[model samples]
Target chain A: MASEAQSSAPDNLPLVLIHRIPPFELSFKSWLPTRFRLLDPLDPSFSSPQTQSLVSSVRLLLCLGPSPLTSDTLDRFPSVQCVVGSSAGLDHVDLATCCRRGITVTNAGDAFSADAADFAVALLIDVLRRVSAGDRFIRAGSWPAKGQYPLGSKLLFSLVNITDNQTWWLFQLGGKRVGIIGLGSIGSMIAKRLEPFGCIIAYNSRRKKPNVSFPHYENVMDLATNSDALILCCALTNETHHMINKDVMTALGKEGVIINVGRGALIDEKELVRFLVKGDIGGAGLDVYEEEPEVPRELFELDNVVLSPHRAVATPEAFVALQEVVIANIEAFFANKPLPSQIELE
Target chain B: MASEAQSSAPDNLPLVLIHRIPPFELSFKSWLPTRFRLLDPLDPSFSSPQTQSLVSSVRLLLCLGPSPLTSDTLDRFPSVQCVVGSSAGLDHVDLATCCRRGITVTNAGDAFSADAADFAVALLIDVLRRVSAGDRFIRAGSWPAKGQYPLGSKLLFSLVNITDNQTWWLFQLGGKRVGIIGLGSIGSMIAKRLEPFGCIIAYNSRRKKPNVSFPHYENVMDLATNSDALILCCALTNETHHMINKDVMTALGKEGVIINVGRGALIDEKELVRFLVKGDIGGAGLDVYEEEPEVPRELFELDNVVLSPHRAVATPEAFVALQEVVIANIEAFFANKPLPSQIELE
Candidate 1:
């Protein structure tokens, strides 16, 4: 961890503890006072003396990545004014304990919307075009000679007549059914992006979102059966786990494509593999997997699927947004201002 | 082949010798009233009598793949009118001999444009996202239990202060610079697709065409140097071969990405491997290679590059277009009408 620049805050304000992440370095340097320690408190072990130090000076705690915020850990930060999570999802942070302690909690809301949207589209195109497969085919020394290798298929071919059609035609995306699960910022952005592509969007969410163009479906099965493509952009929770199982897979179109940019636990991985292998549905593009890092080898061999290691919001823009939001939340707590991105805890 | 769907053409007219390749059958059921044969002309020991029978029957010879068209071979088809090549590039067919014999030639123009464009865009996105590298990392089993792999850089984060300024905001085209070479139909479509992502389109061609909105660079060197991402969509002829050699490569940006959907001969492959190894360009995506089927094995080891096995036009739509166009030429010749897509033999 780098040394704190210099404190810009008054002498009476409680200190904030933030773990230094990449782009966060720039935001912390820009917005916060020098005295704040952007250090990893999880170093070696969280000892009693270190806990006492945190309790003595820290008025706010900033968290990023997968670091845990247990009640035991938070108890040491006695002077902590608030907890700010630098991510839209707050699964890692224990919100109930913070709420009980009367500690304000905020998050970097909607910061990753563009990154997620861009990646979702990227994954969709990648899978449809078989980009990864092409790369592998070339790398494996099986590249065919001229007039030997097969040409790629076009997306429009699936929509329009290619034979005996003399007239130039554009594909119709309008009236094409698209389903989105979890209508959060990422999903909403995806819906908006699809508008230009001419797909009719439907979503399944616990609550209907107002001021959206897409229609909402109460049942995941209904959405699944009706859509040409199903997008899983929802967060994973106990209720949401395995939301897309064998039944949902059966409802999708034979030529339909599925894209997942959210948590993998929301999908039944074994079923997805089975369905994909049997061509139960068309194809799938996944950025997240049920098992992280260890993507099933079978997925790689399939021509109808595209896979990316869980990195939907891993763009530079998202990182910068994350940094800015985290610093703002920390600064607000120090100056007694309302936190920018507030979160509710059970 | 499948007995020529009963032709009704007069016996006195120049017989059209249509040799349809076996296994991958060409549907000539409704093509025309013509004399056709399923001749294995590609066989090295093909009999001269069979050739003579073809030459005597048809004044026009339509060849699908690269089978040598010699005067001696055509002598058998004395009444043959002309030769129509099925593909775009006339590398396989002898254009000079066709011109000398007063034989008109034609090819399927713009048939693979959309497929090629779609592929170029897919490669660009894959290279930018490091999707290929992520796949390699997981397969290599270097994944850590937690935070073991470094977070790959995103397209959006490279911008300095996009949040503060709109100029920088537009700079993230899906989030990067996209440079195109040869603003032909495929190139133009690529630019159009990228327009939604706010890409700054620039190109270098032999001469600029009219009505194009994007900036044009007269010099290829300048285009290569200025572009953060480069795509080669130019045609292959005397002038284009080895155009992207060492000098042009040197001009490209450090983080530049290259996608070649055009002819493999357009780029100097030896220079490209050297440049990639030296990290002159951040990454590359290629569908065509200098030597067909025999791509440099070193490209496999490089995590930065993505290679496709010349399958850009292998799509179902493109294949259907190819079929329709080939049939059109045959029909036009028999009907004594103008060919839809004529290729002038200079």
Candidate 2:
């Protein structure tokens, strides 16, 4: 049965246009060889005559990871009606153009939500408890030399140096006020995961969601003001780009932590660096950066920061789930059926 | 009111013997002044004159962090009726001796449970998700150079290297079977936290616990055979010392992860190091070692291991809570009331 499913003949198979940058192509071919035929516009061997027929007849477009899907690319395939976004976040795709063309957009949706939310919680605990930093400390052989990690400050460990002992405290997960920037599927899942940690869940979204009991902040500033930690879970849109600016960082304050699993550019990267370096903010746990694969050099030395290489949904299971979703969306589109993860454009 | 509480005239108050080594002294004195007078025989100025009189009258002894409480130490304070343990783990205290002498023992039970459980979950996620390793990768500037940090083998990342790709997979916590060694307070809390992550929880304790629905294994080997990970949360005692030996490690297999937040001696350190170095086990996230403050030098170079100083309950809040519990227990002992965290010996 496995061998029979691995069909490679595609002379008359339904063609789907694959969009991706150089060295960043999707490997969905092996998953569904007989289900559909994928045509790559970026392929160098595609000479004119047959390419025009193939490109003009394609009705579905598969947008690969972080690849820009523009109107010009869409214009080549006038028959294209649906763009299957392989990522949970569709920031790179031109949603406005898709709206104008009446083209439907589908996403991985809940396929990556759990993984991303799990990562958000992981980063939160890792930062709050200093998991990664503690590992680094032990790896550097600093445990015996430094006496103890002292989660808050070294001075707090020595009873002799403690001045106002009653007021002194350290980081613990219970009773922490965490404000989420987005309360979508991933954000809600993050809230669910944090519920048992005894975290106070609040959120700031484009608009307040209905039937949800978490306190809503009208704006990011208000959310930051009330939160001990601000988790950026919103997308990177024109309005949301650099939403977490200097004022927002200042509002979060010196004792606040920031965990970002959303798209980069959601925060002002330079300002965040300055605040972290100046000890103006407490700490940050980042899985995405404004310029990913090129994290700020300043973060390399900061113990308060945890830097990841934009891999919140890079798990093999997520990759498989995404491919299945993309295939199902295409099959649904051709049959005039409701897509599994169709996104309504505003 | 605050000044009235900080009384230094501990002279004539009810005397309690403070049992601790040179550096491991309890700071409970400042928390409850004017309540009790502590007699320390270890003090250089604790010369014969008043020491004998004070030692003879003392009925309570405070055992500070990890300081040995052998029968010999108990012999020094023959009049002591109860030992107040300042930590959650009472392995250092001679519980058998206390039982034989008909002396009661109280510990910091639920006080440190939450923090330790939180740390255990943090370590588990950190190990399985490669949180620390990912941080290290980004810090080392390998993100730009290397494409991504594969949670499993790097071979799984490249589709170009696909050979028997169907059987090859990566790690995700959703469906993982986690076997906990001890389903005590800390272990139960760890299970509660992991429930949201969709993990399958099972356990092995001294015997089957009452009212628990999770599957129970009679021995460590059986638990290891069925688990994707093993979390050690049981106390260190004669039966538990090196309970996770070479046979247990072999049973856990190459894809298994070990998270130890209980005690160092829970697993044989040298054997653990050998297993980790040979990749016989998948990974480990350790907060304690067999010989802590001196981790195996071999672990320093392994990516699959995360080493931390034995500071699982070193949070400031835990410290304050512990101090309060110790004071409460001492107060209850004098009032002939039930202690908050008194241990019953079999």
Candidate 3:
């Protein structure tokens, strides 16, 4: 009853459109400020003529979770000038339509960066150290039946380089060369976190960042060739889709590891599976997949691979941070101030 | 015949007794230097009068692995002035006998510290972030069937203290207060490695380290009370055996985590299992157990627990570093030089 009364607020407050599926609506409503008059499409009143007229007058839309903000949806709200994204990636948003309509877009920029970077490192260590496999081995009552969980590759201060011929020979993480695919907030956080571990950081981005000192590789192939591991942290774009193809995998060689926290399609799933199965590459720690929620069945049996449901950014702290960012962006827009995390459409 | 000739080398080189079970003998032989004439007990010549005389003349005994260097074993080697340990922990050695004989004992020292420290951090991240559990969820094809893998606790920055009632709520690793047990080489390395993650570190050791700055808790319970996590990295000694009992674990409380890179006996296995099963503690990342290779079956069912079969020091890099330390200690002992990694048997 309170929410119903609040939903029918006066016109003094700016109208904001809340876009999310049924499951996430209650949670979003719980944190969102009641000062702003909210218009949720899922409401029964949304189909009424009066509510439709009200939605048409909305100036801001809050994109929540994985809800799609397609062109058709954008066409409904003719007066919407800005879309505040609650997630870091904008792949689900119809950015082209937003750009055409001159709609400003703001994302949950650095809010998820630290958590995502932490997950990236967690996955990397899991793959290299065989954390999950060892857990499985011990869980299946293999410790007593088996003498030891098979030794994992080393992670610090070792002389040998991993090779297909020498899978058992471990190398240290301290001096290993790591190539980052993107140099954005998440990527930079990952690099900063890993620097203390003595990793040799290099990266490949759209352009060389003038102030950054990490070695720059002009292309993914070159980055793979010089790196012991390639960490995918770049946003998924037309140019980046399937960028880690067969050639790049080949350049990464037999002993290389790949840690992907970016997106599933950034890597050629078939090629990656083949490389892993054939020992063409050492291992993989993947949080995202080509078709997530459906990881390749072959990976289930491999001790060298570590797989996670696409949850690199799904942490309680991250969710709270996301809420803060979203609210900050909305408040800034309403105050005629610059959006806190606005993304350039170009 | 070639092996026989090599083992029967002239008196010019220092004679070192190789003590290990059959399994590790070959690996030890592969890495040991040829400059020293090695006497193997498993060899047929070892029981012969000539080999017995040769064994009696040995000045250094190289303990290849977990082979027991008992008081009786020490008595056979009347001239053994130094016992070269090939492993980081020297619990297998009869230190009292070595002390009485004025025999210098040298361990792997800092050689295995880096790898062990790395593994400790890996386990901590894996447990707190549910890295291994998330891996299992995806690998089991639960992502599609289960919708989303559960969100893990935060890792970079968050402000929630873990409590029994809030077991499912995750917090970031960045600002958690971590208490280190032992604060020796591996403990110090673990602290150094975690500092970049923004963890506040305190420690408990035999005595308050004068030069160190971390708050020293003289008792384990006090350390546990103040810590969000307790990383066990101390050696197993008479006083430290079962150091982490029910009381200390209770002090750590429901939301605290325990990471063990030390010997299994450092924690009371039975008490640990009870605490974990009852949800009296948050979670654990265990690489060692009381009766290793015989981990508690109850731990296998818990998603919060991560188990590795005593592999914190089993990496190839560790093995190589171990060889270097063993060689250095032996060379130094023979040259009338101070043993590089000598342990005081006080």
Candidate 4:
């Protein structure tokens, strides 16, 4: 259903500057222009003068894909007061620069939270239960030829006696301390979904969220020490880069598992590999890596690690949701209403 | 925490005929002797004369693992009045013969439900999100070689247009109608866990459970027609063997997923292989098979199915719980109290 105000002619409709790099086109690109007349600078049809004129007049800009949203890009659209991000995580967008410019930013949190959260849980379960490892064993004809894929119980760090190495493969989730790195829309949903499975939920966000009943650790080390699994849900920033290092992994001990869905640089990838290879850490389930597309070849051989392309929010439902959030944010901006998923700048 | 009655001398303790085939040892075998005076004909120490006298005296017997319990085995233990099962699904136990002989039966439902339910949910999420497939792509160096994993939307059967194959990769869990075949302990737990994920739960049990609020279909075919996924949680009895045949798969259609943490013979393995190969069915997550440790070669070629060697209830927590249940049932039977998890003999 089109809002009455959205029915205006192309020239009369509020313009949204489409800021995206090559090969990173916006999802739902075809339908985007139906609501608002889009002004994509990269489009060949937008002559230099026409693009300049539209950029100067447009009050809102849309940042699509994980391409860089640098200060130089923002400089081209000095008139854009609000940046409607097409993703939940704004690691690609220069949040600090946007904050300095007093440019309000709205993310795709409303759209991406559920599916991203679901994927996080999926990865966690896979690693703990050896779901991928078992599938590999079966596909390789090891089930019939190799006799049995290790059915011995694994004593997890979450509920372990470290002195005992003979413990059975527990593959148990109940009564484990699951420390969430961020308590935003995605992390909180993860906590909620895991609660019924008997996980003891806690968190270590930048700032402790108010009124949240989950115990909040002030730092990553403390959280890692107390957690069986560490799930990353916050953004990647200067402060958080390499936040999970050797010392933090040491504190997590030999039985802890780490799951990352936020970004590749959240953990020191090199350190993580060494720990996994040496069996210093129990296991890891990673969706995003320190580098895109190039996963550590070393990881390919380890059954303890699960690697995924950066596609946590790649589901069709998330796309539909992203479109709604983008459309709502733009329309709200023009209507002088509060944006649906605007990020509160520190 | 030994019960006072269990502190008696082994010779004074009541005898429980340990009826098990080779390789089918009790999960907590060593711990069983502390609670009962076990009589096993298969034990070499128990000479044929000792076994004959003990078997005729024992009033209770324990059926461990998935080995068959035939009428011949029952005839040898003429005095046994109750059979205590050490596993949840009793496909191996001959129920009709026991019922005809007016003997009672009990299963390890309490011990197996939580872990079994957790695995079922794990496989469902894995199949739907292509968790294993993504991991495979990354491990195979295909992530770099192949620009993107399909990432297309799969229009599901429950809320679908059957003709349109161009839909996005939904990977959606919310709003999907999940039909559970048996609304027993494990099935109910699965429904509870999925409720937090926003799944619409329904069931197709032998009869509608008295007060379960979820909608119930009288037959598997009707349930398949109306649902997007079918999870088998019941036993593989004669009535239920091959219940999910081609007709049911056709009704579930191209977009439906099936998860079986129950016995694999619950669905016709040959027909399922054909459907998965033809893309006639969406996907499957199986922990058991019609044949032990022998998965079809065709399934290995398809990414749609996730297979786990029959280890659904193999966890330390489950073992600990099973010991508790087994002890409780034996204690209750000897004390003349109702057996804790006794199956109703119809």
Candidate 5:
């Protein structure tokens, strides 16, 4: 069911429009006035005329996804003040049209970074420890017959180093090089967490941000070559698709690990399989893949890969935070105050 | 192969007898005397007169296991000076026989307590969080699949009042009720480690020690009833066998977890399985079993159990420490010194 906040723009209605919301977005009343209409951008019933009718009543539009608004749709909303998106990427919104109409635009930027970082750490531990393999062994009835499975490799065991029956010395996370593919919101937060673990953070983004503390690499291969763990948190634009191909995988070395919490299309799936099979790279922790609903069955066969069901933001805390921020941004636009996170045309 | 230390004791040299061990015993050198003919009262091999080759050369008899010396074995080691046992349980050794023979008896009272405690805590987290389940999911290729498997529970899914992210807040061990079955060396160490986590530690043993900081319960059911997590770190003696039976399971409440890093016989497996199936108890983490190498397949099928192959002390560090301690205990007996731990005659 559509969230009630998305369905009705209440009486003191400052005239707001919203679209491209999931079924369970944030509760709007907690942070914003009820005078906001958060439209469903992907609503099957939406037509050209209906889009125009909805836009005509709003002073602002909270757009999500990559749906462009045509001139006719803009004509109905003469009082439109701004267009805000609940996503970081603004490719779908008609920035030129909004600028012509003097409508400002903003995007939800860097909000989901910590959630993604947490997921990266979880996946990394899952892969290294073979946590999943032990579970399968018990279910398969191979445990008691075989006694305990042979001790898992000490290389991947992330827990403490136990000794003398009482004192436990934990493994240190400090002093490892971490390669970030995209230096965006998620990528930066990942570096922040790793800092306490004593990691030397490095990044290979499309354009380097000067104000950052991590070393930047212009070449992804160089970053992969130097890093002990390579993280993929970049945007999936056409120019950066399948950036982690066979050549990049080869450069990662046999001891290096790869983590991807971003879009699956950003890595070369066949190349990853080949590298894993050949032991060219140590391990991989992936939350997303090239294809949804059907990942390569071979990925499951490898002991070094940690796979999750695209659930980095599946935590209840992140889910609620997502809704709260999206609704607040929408509300801010209608009231003619500064939007929570505004996007603009270059 | 048996550990090297087990095989190196000189058969023709002065004999050192270690008798009266606990139910769970490992052959480690925690006593003194670097070289001697070591006699184990609990060894099935000790029954035959053919094993009495050290009758003439024996100088010291070290009591380690709880098994008392039978007249046949004592007659064979006439030159023995000391009978030292490195266990709290003196059930296997005859203290009167040693006293009559004018042999000093020693015990290794609490060397393994802290390690056992650490093991209990690890098992609890492993079972409840489904660290094993997550491992199995990846191995089965059911990850990220729709209608696949019961996903592992997040860390803080049951906290009563917490606004912060449960995942982050509950990941660390703090503010949890941890119940100890026996307030022995291991149980006390568990309480110490859990104390830093803000855990309220409680114990149910023969009688609570006056020096311990943790609270005491009169019965096993009371301990289970009050604990958020009940840890079985007690020895498998007559009074404690099957202590956590159906009634204790019922008292533990549906949210309480049980961890048995001690002897598995302390918990009733049949009742545990029934409780797990009916959702009558929260969960359990087991290392040892009532019957070794004969675990039921049904236990693996349950989501509430985490099984370790009785290898909690199998860490390389622990192995090294065991070798050192067991060797020293044996050597001290040969040197005519006071044993590290002495067992009092009942």
Candidate 6:
């Protein structure tokens, strides 16, 4: 390492560090305030001794995307006072290490809630109504070849008249029993958005929230038992990992659908695939997978499973909102003001 | 024609006429009340000389699907008093003849409304969010090949920061202005469903609905001029036929989306194809075509448009509801009770 004297004099502007891996750099550099000098490790001078000295003095770090911010990485920037996360889920960040180090953490809170909730509803409708499957059918030049696509399940009321050759039915959305997992900001928004569609809402969370009228279940299994659809909106943690196993899925039964807008590891992907393959579960609308960008090949041919490229929070509107929150957190940190959306650390 | 003397004696049950072309017979025959004797034209007895005399005394006709109910056909059943239409749209029936003959018409009333509204919303979301396109991307194994799918339009706010190397964006649904054509039951329900999504709702109809608060326009052009999306929910009548022609589509502009859940002729299919092909309008989610089962083949390759096989009302639940309404109408007609879903002949 070069001597301290080799480093250039610090500018008057406050210094901020940007932690991101290659090909995933921050795209909102111009949107950030000019009052801070952003130190990017990917820069050409990053390996230089003088630049390393500057890196050690980075008091504020902006963690963009899934860039790992492990304890060892944090050790290089010993002066990091606050870590402002630009993504909704901070799984990449070692939150426990940050908490132990007494470093404040902020995330993009409520900024992506609306878009995520909208996507969850979209996925549910897509799976239930077979929107994507119908699109595929039409795209394959199969409409003329195939007289009509198969019908989806009826919404709630059952009028099953089984004749030898004919059956009369209706698939509605007016009264579906929807069980929401993790009734947080995103979950509550999902519930509110689905209310007008006349869906019956229930939830399974860490604890029953006060002033909420929706029925709450202590366990995910019980929630699945009563719901026609289960929307996963909870954060992934040690407790929630593999929470949706075979038993829980079995309880949801053959007519129950699953919509996941949360993290992939929150569910047992292998079990989900098995259940889906066996036709034990009604359908699934997945935006995330256990090993993303590597979805099960078995799901490729299934009509009931709708696969998305983890794009629930990929809306342009959500990004603008996220940018606002990220900027606010940065400004608040520099101005000695409270952060706009700090994550509560346990 | 057979003489009255050659006609067989009337059965104890009331006689009901079923005017359906071959291969399109109603599947709810067993569900029909045993009190009425259904007279199917395809019945082998109908070719018999005495069957013609029996047909003349039929007072109730059940028109199933799109079977033509022309005046010439009605003339064969001169004693027909009530026409119970099992389908929602009455375009196939000669309403003029029905009115002239003072024949009351009952249709599948609110039976199919919920499913239609649900489908309308589903189509709208699919078009706006590009759910079908994204699904296609994942299904074709393009996610790993192509890192990110193209971003859709921003929901409401504008943040155009186009750098030479990088750009930040999001496509949102929360703040879209949705214009509903035809403020009837389906239109109103579509508005109600989209309200929770933070969508701004407006409408165009023949007459302004009382007790309604949404901004209403008398002309569809004015409605399309200000809307990001136009949801066609009006009945296809002479006045409304091709109402969404070139002028209205042009006014909807480049970023506008069209969702048709109503009859196919409500829009000029030829004009729509040109607009969609030229990128004059952003996208479409069409369930009905001008000559359905024969959609414009051009739309098959387009990524923006979502083509559904006129399946908005093809759900089992809708069929069950339709069976209920049909049974109710038939029972009421025989009981001299008020028809459950009568259509007023204007």
lDDT by residue (tens digit), candidate 1, A21-90: 4423333344244445443454444455754455466777777564567888788677775888866666
Write down the C-alpha DockQ for each prediction.
0.19, 0.43, 0.40, 0.40, 0.11, 0.38
lDDT of 3 by residue, B57-157 (tens): 88898886666788998898899999988778899899989999899899988988887888899899888878888887777777788554333222111
* Error of model 5, residue B312, in angstroms: 3.9
For candidate 5, what is the lDDT? 0.61
B69-136: candidate 2 lDDT, tens digit per residue? 88888887888899999888898898998998889999897878888988898888777767888899
Query: Candidate 3 chain B — worst ten consecutive residues by lDDT sum?
Result: B152-161
Each model's lDDT comes to 0.67, 0.82, 0.81, 0.81, 0.61, 0.81
TM match of model 3 to true structure = 0.92
| Candidate 6 TM-score over all chains jointly | 0.92
lDDT of 2 by residue, A17-127 (tens): 888765565555465646677788787645567766688788898887768888887887898888988778898898999999999999887878888888899898887
Q: Candidate 4 vs. truth: CA RMSD? A: 4.2
TM-score of each: 0.79, 0.92, 0.92, 0.91, 0.60, 0.92
Q: Native-contact recovery for every candidate? A: 0.27, 0.41, 0.44, 0.46, 0.08, 0.47
After superposition, candidate 2 runs with Cα above 4 Å error: A1-9, A29-31, A147-170, B1-10, B29-31, B147-170
Clashing pairs in 3: A155-A173, A264-A289, B153-B170, B154-B172, B155-B173
Query: What lDDT score is found at residue B38 in candidate 3?
Result: 75
TM-score of chain A of 5: 0.74
Q: Any idea how many clashes model 6 has?
A: 13
* Better candidate by TM-score, 4 or 5: 4
Docking outcome class, model 2? acceptable
Count of clashing pairs, candidate 5: 64
